[model samples]
Target: MSDVGDRNGGNDLVRFEGVTKRFDVAKPALDAITGAVRGGEITGLVGPDGAGKTTLIRLMTGLMLPESGTVQVLGFDTRKDPAAIQAGIGYMPQRFGLYEDLSVQENLDLYADLRGLPRHERAATFDELLAFTDLKRFTSRLAGKLSGGMKQKLGLACALLKKPKLLLLDEPGVGVDPISRRDLWKMVENLTEEGIGVVWSTAYLEEAEACDRVFLLSEGKLLFSGEPKDLTARAAGRVFRVSGIPGRRRQMLTKLLDEDGVVDGVIQGDAIRLVTVKDRETRFSAAGDAEVTAAEPRFEDAFIDMLGGGPGGRSRLAETQRSFTVEGEKPVIEARALTKRFGDFTAADNITFDIPRGQIFGLLGPNGAGKSTTFKMLCGLLKPTNGEGRIAGFDLRRDTAEARNRLGYMAQKFSLYGDLSVSQNLQFFAGVYGLHGAHKRERVDLMTSIFDFRSRQSMSAKVLPLGLKQRLALACAVMHEPEVLFLDEPTSGVDPITRREFWTHINGLVEKGVTVLVTTHFMDEAEYCDRISLIYRGRSIALGSPDELKARVANAENPDPTMEDAFIALIQASEEERMAA
Candidate 1:
């Protein structure tokens, strides 16, 4: 990383004083927010969807001005000196604009030209950036063809071409796997050594925990601002791990979450991690035969607590769901020898799995690792070269329509009609799912009530917040109440509370005999699965429950292995074996 210039005498690189930004909505995107970013340190803009993180980041870049207060970037007020702020900062928006058809080198050259790098200096700068991002070997490759991780690296490279004093990254880690996220963090941390101030806006609390300071936002309000450790300290002595329940962690967690003193709970490996109300740690001892022990607090625990705790109790949607049943004890969803090839390049190689009724099966892998291929094949969106995908005993290829009708699919991205209102989208989906007249009206009403979409029912689907959009997509998918559900990264960029709410609904559905097949980048979500198939380079690498998978990678050096640890280790072992072969 190149040193931009001499560090500012003062540590504060950016300052927000009573910053308030509003759009057409009733509530301001950022309401009277006050914060500061210091040089040589990372400041995290942490929040749920529509929490004003993006709006705050945009203000820092001078792309937008606040309505009430001033945003000063590098000692220049954004309103007065937007051009100067733009010139002296590197801003990577959520979707970095990279010309898809252009080669990697060409894109870099374009960004260099746009940033006004002199012709003589372009070569050295390009070389340095390519080496730093490890994209030198793929310079000739088209930007569109690069993997998700590589594309992010290229975007970062483009932003760094001018080596501005401040770097603004808005959810850059979205959709990227854990390995790629780690690499991106390492790259940014190295740049901070040269005194570049970074404002990282993210939904992942783990990323927030690594930041030197964090400003937590919720519903356009600043909830907290300080070092991550200080926030985590708030949840100390409140977190606990309840174990000794085999094959019943989720059940216990659901119950505990609804208990009087329990604030939040989740299934963690073979145990249920709980965070109790402050000063209510000694409420109870045993949960049936289970043992409760105090566990270390994490940033997520603190984050959820600050967000008024998770949306507890059973899912309203699940409660309204009718029971589903299949005869003969056959697997509800099956993938037999699934394989897909594009011009001799295997996207999925002989993958196979069977999900019993009511089971939550997870498909996990790094970006471009073929989990999507497997998912699409099962959904009947893509044709497999050789294999049979069965949904509720209906063959995907042979009985395509029958198979599709029995399943509901929530895609990775929000696939709802952007121009349509929430009610209109739900009605359309109900019709498509074969409901009619009174039945359609009933289902739509149920969805609106269950997902709490009545207030914003007339709002365009595109205008809703990320969390609401996700809820709408899910509502549309499950409105018909299919026997099987396929969720493709349903909680990719949402906050921890939103994720918990999603899982609560999903778990409730499972309890009512709804089989689920899901793909996710978040390791915590993977732990909720009854079993996971870890895919890499178009092949299944590890197949087991969350606990079983963690045990596989556990040792004295790291006796307690997280799902991410197990995932990375298994992938590394597979790569080494392939290289040896």
Candidate 2:
């Protein structure tokens, strides 16, 4: 569009002139890309994983040279004067280097010294940074002890110590909770207001809405670039909200997905957000009684539509899999008064919840709020200082081994053997679960086909892409066909389409009597859960269905709240009540 083109040697804060970069024999990471960022505005680079977002940020920071074209930063040629370019820019990588042994103030002083700030100037700069980041109270605490959100804020403070002319942040909030993400964005907005240019990259489409200009990149190509509102206009009159019977949601979703003109369907708070191929009236017959209504298009809807629906992949669930019904009135999993402590500090305090058979349960909270502590206690990996838990009717404390036999756990980091072949890892996990001989062969073959990894079975797991890695991890976890599944941050770094595919498999398992307990930073994914428990500072703050949680936060101003809004509102309200107490 008119928003992006040849700058013609203009003096923009940063400019990419047909820049191209490659690694070894692979296709160019950035292929003839050109863009400009002004001094007092925010520019967002939005794309999927491996879309060269990180590479582009590296080029701008003078970490790597463009092979053919030029990249200018603050009027200095990146190739000829890399140091000069780096001097005027601040860069925050996805994984920044912070000394765990150093205190917060020590880290800040080190960065200031490296940047050569005078002692007189250092006092005011440090004061401003510590105040802005809300880290003044924790200045003497070790950086390693800070929460994820505080760590990010500390990095931002250090990057700004030199009064950077331009700032580059690469996926700063990828795994951060919604509240931390909001704080980071608010700080970025403040930076832009002070006349510092910013070029940020993110896989989250919702974040793109905050940028003044956004560039949508896929497979190293710029598909669309313009104002956020202008890009969303492309999908006007093309989105709808579908409502159906509560228990029949699974069946309704399948039918809509199979419809001809349907682009995609995802579960919102209490409805299915449906999108069509184009801006026209199309037909969608609900398999049951469901109502459809025209709705406003979100930035996510437009991005998905503009990218041609989604990442098409085949569903490979077993055709002969039988329908599963709950066999009893009692819940399949339960945790009673669970509490975990480290010495004198309580990480998880008196937490309790239950999940019925064939239901999806979500545990949501901010970083360092004891989600992992609770997860570990329920999974029987760690001993609870007090209380007890049960899985598949087996006691977590008295019969840990028996309880473990009927459950599967997938860690947040996808603990796969990177050096081994896909089939090898599957075989190893199968052996661990006591599958042998014909049964082992059958299970391996079935999992291989179900995840559509048969063709790449011999490939090393490390060589596979992020999406494939995620699929393989999930497949390996479910190899035992356990009655309960535990997924922690299951969709963290992957893109939206892959996330949808992953959830589809989980949904099918729910139909097969498998109970799931999941945690996620993405609030949209929380909508898929039958019920959710909001956790904060080692306690359960609220528990309800997705619609119930949203209703609790809804009012005249935002009567129909998105999951993010509901989460923030509830969290803020909880904080207020605690302070009042």
- Clash totals, every prediction: 0, 0
Per-residue lDDT over 1-581 for candidate 2, one digit per residue giving the tens place of the 0 to 100 score? 11111332443688888988888456878888988887777889887767788888899999899898898888777878889877888988877567779999999999888888889998899999999999999999999888878888998998899888789998788778999999999999999888788988886778888899988887777777789999888778888888855565755676677787778778775688888887456777763567788899888888887767753222455232444565774788898999999998899999888999989999999999998889988899999999989997899999999989888898887699999999999999999888999989998999887788888999999988778998888887888888788999988867787788888788777877788999999988999998999899889898999999999998999998888998899889999999999
Q: Give Cα-based local distance difference scores for all models.
A: 0.89, 0.84
lDDT of 1 by residue, 527-576 (tens): 89999999999999999999999999999999999998999999999999
* lDDT, candidate 2, at 457: 92
Model 2: ten consecutive residues of lowest lDDT: 1-10
- Model 2: lDDT equals 0.84
Best by lDDT: 1
Return the lDDT, model 1, position 537.
99
Best of the candidates, TM-score = 1
